[model samples]
Target: MQPFPSQPLDHDSLHEECGVFGVIGVPEAANFVALGLHALQHRGQEAGGIVAYDPERGFNGAHRFGYVRDNFTKASLMETLPGALAIGHVRYSTAGSKAPVIRDVQPFFGELAMGGCAIAHNGNITNAAALRRELIERGSIFASGSDTECIIHLMARSIQTSIPERMKDALRRVEGAFSVIAMTRTKLIGVRDPLGVRPLVLGTLHDGAHVLASETCALDIIGAEFLREIEPGEMVVISGGEVASVRPFAPAQSRFCIFEHVYFSRPDSIIGGRSVYETRRQIGVELAREAPVEADMVCPVPDSGTPAAIGYSQESGIPYAMGIIRNQYMGRTFIEPTEQIRDMGVRLKLNVNRALVKGKRVVLVDDSVVRGTTSRKIKDMIIAAGAAEVHFRIASPPTAWPCFYGVDTPHRDKLLAAQMSPEEMRDWIGVDSLSFISLDGLYRAVGEAQGRDGACPQYCDACFSGDYPIPPSDQIANGGFDPEGPTTLSDHTAP
Candidate 1:
């Protein structure tokens, strides 16, 4: 396995860690997992893996370094991982570098003292480095740089008698956000962190098989009925056609990642009982009420910003137009690892529509601005396309702080919002005007009408508010920079 390396900070956009999916009591379980992972492909694109458990075959695993459609869809690959219980992961590296090695791919399996188990995890472990050091001192051998691998090793060392008990023991020793799905020979398990920093939902298929996934969309893909969200600090174990709930951790105020409604989750998915697309549109409505702009048309940055822009246009009574067109074939540019490729910027993914933008005062609605690089490039493109004026409106508040949870955010110094005031950013991006939704407005958009409470906020807004629900132990200990500075840990784990 490759050693962990510091990745160069990419200022364009934030990335969520990964997505987990699991199913039990289903025939051809690996195939169902593949479909679930495909629905959640938006969460991670670099690598995908599935682990299945059969009484006869024991545990069979398949790990691939590419899109789920390209890897997990093939019948040959699915056939190789046959079983009645399965768990899968689509990975976006938050800890390690951009490497494509198989070892870094997930659904990491281990033969533990209790039983054989395979685990897939979403979210970052802020104390992974420290935990790794402690485990190493105890003679634990690691096969991958992934922090998820640390959980497997922790389980192996646990003195608990059952797999579920051992998992709880392992989780209690770690810190930061996590939504885990693990499978053993006869059971499947799912757990969310105390704060529910990342999302995990439970569903049931038509055949009465239980399903656990990062989002409701994953459940929708397989005609699964949305049962409910996995409660914070709760674990559900499925076996023998029965689902048992276990509360292994003390109750804490929930701090689900707010970015999920902003960009991480698929628009079709419902989070916190709110439609993700509707919430984004509501955010646009809130943005319009909070920061109205006079313009010929309201335009989105594309794909990510589309729903919010529509809401803005409707609320403002301004006509919405396709002022910017996106290249659907291109992957997200922010995930590009090398400076050379990322320096090319938004041009590879988006283009300004001269017909719609020329001679028009365009209002550009986007999810959020991180580095100002992409926004600056986009502003220039709009002006060049003959836009008389470019007004920038963001759905979320300025991202002034780094996220140590599942989201891949830049360090404090690298964040544009952290470094400059709104006016300064407007001048730097060369836009006529720029406005971000107020923190209260953001909360209102997400259905928290009273707005965020200073003492007990409704959701995790650390990226926007700097009020971290959990302390970043490793960062605090190491002076906030990884030992390896801006170096790729692996070749293909960029996002």
Candidate 2:
């Protein structure tokens, strides 16, 4: 496997995997699915796709390389997908290259001996390369470069007489984080990996339709009543407006991604019945308590850092100020695929408020620092704007390891934390002082008051601690593990 080309700006942050949404028993299901995808646009912005099942048309799919609102909102486009059941995906390339063609945009549909199934997946398959090699050796032709296509091929070759059984068989052979929404001719299915590293939620429409989404924000957009989060190792098949649940794999302790509370989820989303915004604010409070500093004002790094900054201000008795303003029209810097565009960097989206920062000892709060590029640039911008001093407070621990599950993280060598100590980073970024929240404090912020349990941890902190819940088979097979890697995964395998 070729090493991904370095994008200096993007190396500083993590990118979320795709978002999946599906609905059954809803009239014009594509419309509702569209709204759900629109709400989940933050998860992935590279591409969007929808697949709908109509009795007359069988399976109709529309995959486009753009935003859902721009592609799926048109009457002509929505008219192309007519059905009572639909599944959709908003994608960011974590597996294959960043420049994906239309075919890679998913809701990947495959026809099997049992029936046609369309799947929208939100996570990585750790054993995908091995599985792909085995399937290819068995003469299974592939339609896309995505690791997700491996699941479809596995299901097609299954001897099971039903789609759900075939799906279970397929999932059993793979490893890593996965929250999938699939649609068959008669049923809509949702499944979470046994360890539940990724998130998936179930909801119900007032008219008796069942909905599955990667986040509750999607359900809120469509006015669906929140049901509950899909459990680890569980699969649900929705038919005739009723849901049938099954435990397809042996149960294991849940390992939800801790970073979701830090940056991935929308502020309004509720995960594990806890408000995401509240969790972030609590993280800020924890940071303030752990790393108190004297400053005239607390300023966030625009959007992702805003909630935590507010929390830090409240806890420290300092006033929160908007010393840097983000351009509402600009998208996230990490989403820009090309190195040329990313090199343009922080200036494209954020501008310092000279009036607020000038002559002020500002405390800059951000979620986390990856490669240090963004933080360094922001510090420079603050100094240029005449700030007296800048203190950097990170809401989460230093991100020292790469994520093998679903997040698009830089390789070990490129991560700033992997190479530098906290003091070194502070000197490099030219901040007066720098501090990150402790790992245990992060757990406490997410409601784990006892801190992370060593025997059975509550969340996945692989990016910080290198304690991956599942082995990264593909990465290991490719000899991608470095001796200098920041952290190590626990010796465990999914049951």
Candidate 3:
């Protein structure tokens, strides 16, 4: 077992989502997968579980209501969840309603119209309610309010001849984004939406074992070498210890979420062969090239901003120091039960190291600012710690629209940039000055195609540019933002 390091989670993460892992063709797949999921514990800490299958016992699982480390110890797992293939989940509810109820745990299983299957998914489905209605009319009974349940029903009732056929039908029918790992008595499958709005990777162990996960970090933890990224609209199936690929969707263009590099994915993990560390560093390099500042020291918010802070320091010749310390034990701000608590979440989430910033002219490097409340507090913390001056630099463009895929971005009016200019935001956050990387600069930071200027062709820039690939219908948005009733996919599901 790995040592657990506490981080004051973005207590006001203001959003929720999660990570997932699946391993096939290994004798002790669940054991290996548990370790892998632990590595990605930072992606989501709400709940975790692993489901394992063997031809003999079939579908055995161990689930719990806390962090992966809090449950499923190595000793306890030896007596349960023994199998050659497995799937795991770590959730931060982009859809599920609030409640620490264990029923919200994943690797949901049930008897299918054709047979039985178990699934754990990461991402949001925009058209789930519509799909649920369509399937409910066909006599489907759902156990969860999540859109993922809709996929389960669709898979069971599909007219396709094979399991992959049924999955493909379900995939084609769903809108929004999905990076799912599912299993049947005989098959293991992984899929991504056509837009690649979310991330999914395919990898292999030296023993010829196949693995699939939402982040490459999972594979790294379990000693699996990433084979390649699962292409958008592609599905990989493992049956009889052999792997097969299926590309059922037409050749639509790809739009890998660019934010993955900026905020998601562990810096140590690689996506599409690009190290997240290098990517964030590149963002720092670009930020420096686009907006250079005169300051005494460069400091990062904490955790996610450290690598970028190092990059900014390297590029700008500013000395970097550990200025902010995250209180690893805090829950996500978004996970906090009340709005007042969320607004104050950051104060408890991090502490300004007075020794590092006292009387120093500080340059603050962060990935991005959302509602600006969090950043505003960070500035307050720094000023209270005696910083002489503060300049803020963001690694990505300002988010102008809400994300339609899985990202739980804040609403339009709550956005700092929407209501105020950079100067205004600087004043609001109490920073001496603020400058954000340009869209062109952000593209360069991520290594966009040559000669393409700053646009990321394979990037989903809808949230920043208001260029939504598939805009949400008005009624859908109404239902989506609802915190009460069964308005949200999470609210309808078993929270």
**For model 3, what is the alpha-carbon lDDT of residue 247?**
86
| Top candidate by TM-score | 2
- Per-residue C-alpha lDDT of model 3 across residues 17-55, encoded as one tens digit per residue: 778898888887788877878887877777887888876
* Deviating ranges (above 4 Å) for candidate 1: 1-11, 95-98, 332-344, 481-495
| Stretches of model 2 off by over 4 angstroms after superposition | 1-11, 95-98, 332-344, 482-486
Number of the candidate with higher lDDT, 1 or 3:
1
- Residue 232 shift from truth in candidate 1, angstroms: 0.4
Q: Please, what is the TM-score per model?
A: 0.93, 0.95, 0.89
Summing lDDT over every window of 10 consecutive residues in candidate 1, give the lowest-scoring window.
486-495
Per-residue lDDT over 175-244 for candidate 1, one digit per residue giving the tens place of the 0 to 100 score: 8889999998889899999889899999997555999999999999999999999998999999887889
How do the candidates rank by lDDT, highest first? 2, 1, 3
| lDDT of every predicted structure (CA atoms) | 0.86, 0.89, 0.76
Worst 10 residues of 3 by lDDT: 486-495
Candidates sorted by TM-score, best first: 2, 1, 3
